[model samples]
Target: MAEENGAAQPQVKMQVLAQFIRDLSFENNVALKGLTGTEMQPEVQVGVNLDAKARSQPNTFEVNAKFKVTSVNKVNGDTLFLCELDYGGIFLIEGVPQEQLHPFLLIECPRLMFPYIRRIISDVTHDGGFPPLNIDNVDFLALYRQEIARRQAAAQAVAN
Candidate 1:
């Protein structure tokens, strides 16, 4: 809360009301047999997606960060394990201008939620009898820019 020019303003409030694992799935496809104890190191494939949507309440939104990791024995191409996680947070944002809303929601909000989600991924894998997979830092600004360009291209194509 702030006061300026004899008026009260929303003070650019941003808060995370709650965060949780919306969905999670992990598969250890094969027993710990040939998956390990071999000369070849298993390759891990990771996929990531981020999404945000407005909630019914004003200034509230849902932000989702999704991750998928698959492990494969390189030599045999055999599946070792797979894990998919959808993590989300409920956020409250106020007093931001409309022009800044998209980036704020997509980039900033998810930026705040990523660490907790990453830890969940690591813990799930470690408990499943594999090494904890520490995720790398993400560039949210670049991601947001790409998404904006993609949406604009789609709109331009539709306009034509």
Candidate 2:
């Protein structure tokens, strides 16, 4: 519970109104080109980006998580596959202080949507003719901190 003007604040409430895939693309390079090696060893890399914006409806916001996944053959450095996904969720949030809203949208919202994002990635990779790739869970808190630090650095550079 939070205190406002010496009065206890109401409990925060958040609801995911909806979730959808804004965009998705998957390319299997191995299928395009014949496999050169007898054994396939893939090195996968995933990148994540987040964005949030307020909607016209009061207390409603949209949060988007963008993921870019690339896999390459560890031995030959040949590209195996690439997947890019943009997933968005609409949320109705209330009772949270205005000062905490930004972080709530960027961090908590994406954390909630991560499992679905992971599932989509796995399904796409499996259906694309390769083994299912289950990616590791993301650290949204660390990612948020890094982005904040990056913005601060950019601002400092511009000021200098």
Candidate 3:
């Protein structure tokens, strides 16, 4: 709560206006290469990137979460599959202070969109001739802090 002239100010408001996939691609290397193995130990790695921009409408913004998943056979180190997804959401946000808006958009908006993104990846992997891949929950706050630290380090290096 924020105090304004001795009274508490209104709480922040946020709403999801819409969600959609901007781009998606899946490649099944096992099928492509016809790799046959009795023991298939798969190792998967996931990468996430986020972007946000204000919309023309007031108090509205678009946030995009880009996910890339790659699976390789642990035993032979051969590529198994690859999936790339760009998911986005349109949000209606209000009452948030300007200084805090960037973090809110990058952290909160992506957190809200993660579950759907996870499901899509799982389904894509399953349908692509592999076991379902359930991704671990992301800690957006930690990611944001790490990015801030990296930026500071880069700036310091440039200054030096």
Q: Each candidate's TM vs. the true structure?
A: 0.82, 0.94, 0.93
User: lDDT, candidate 3, residue 23?
Assistant: 98
lDDT digits (tens) for residues 1-160 of candidate 1: 3465677754688999999999999987666454446555589888778888999998899999888989888987888889999999999999988888878988998889889978998999899888898878778898888888998999999999
Query: Candidate 2: where are CA atoms >4 Å away?
Result: 1-5, 36-39
- Give per-candidate clash totals: 0, 0, 0
lDDT of each: 0.86, 0.94, 0.92
Angstrom error at residue 157, model 3: 1.3
Candidate 1: worst-modelled 10 consecutive residues by lDDT: 32-41
lDDT of 3 by residue, 74-107 (tens): 9889889999999999999998989999999999
